[model samples]
Target: MTAAALLLWRDFVRDPARRLWTEDSGCGEWGCCGSPLEARAFLEGVLRGMSRRRSRELRAVVDALDDAY
Candidate 1:
């Protein structure tokens, strides 16, 4: 993903209001996350599904985020 997109993900993960989705809640194209843990899982899944070159580029940042939580 682009740096700005990653930054947005990070911000979303850090936001305390990012909670479980409700029937009325509008989820985005990327889906919804109830917590940082779930968001990290989603990120890891994305990484695993991407090409090695792309995954490698973002692995460090993802790992760091994992460590933070």
Candidate 2:
């Protein structure tokens, strides 16, 4: 992710009220990576019954891609 993308994702995910998805969900903070399409895809894939390991792998992708890291 670029600086702008990182900022967008951080601001969005940090805002509790503005969160794109419900809290404490199985998907967790699944849709706050600065991309609505990416988030949607995450939600769909997870809700579609993907394994927990797969979910972690997906999240790892987000963490790795985030420029803030």
lDDT of 1 by residue, 1-69 (tens): 344445655875565665653334444334342333445566778888989997886898877765654
lDDT of 2 at 5: 43
* Tens digit per residue, CA lDDT, model 2, 35-56: 5335544544553575776667
Estimate the Cα RMSD of every predicted model relative to the unseen true structure. Answer: 5.0, 10.3
Error of 1 at 35 (Å): 1.7
Model 2 TM-score, 2 decimals: 0.29
lDDT of 1: 0.60
Q: Best candidate, lDDT-wise?
A: 1
lDDT at 2, model 1 = 44
lDDT values, one for every candidate? 0.60, 0.48
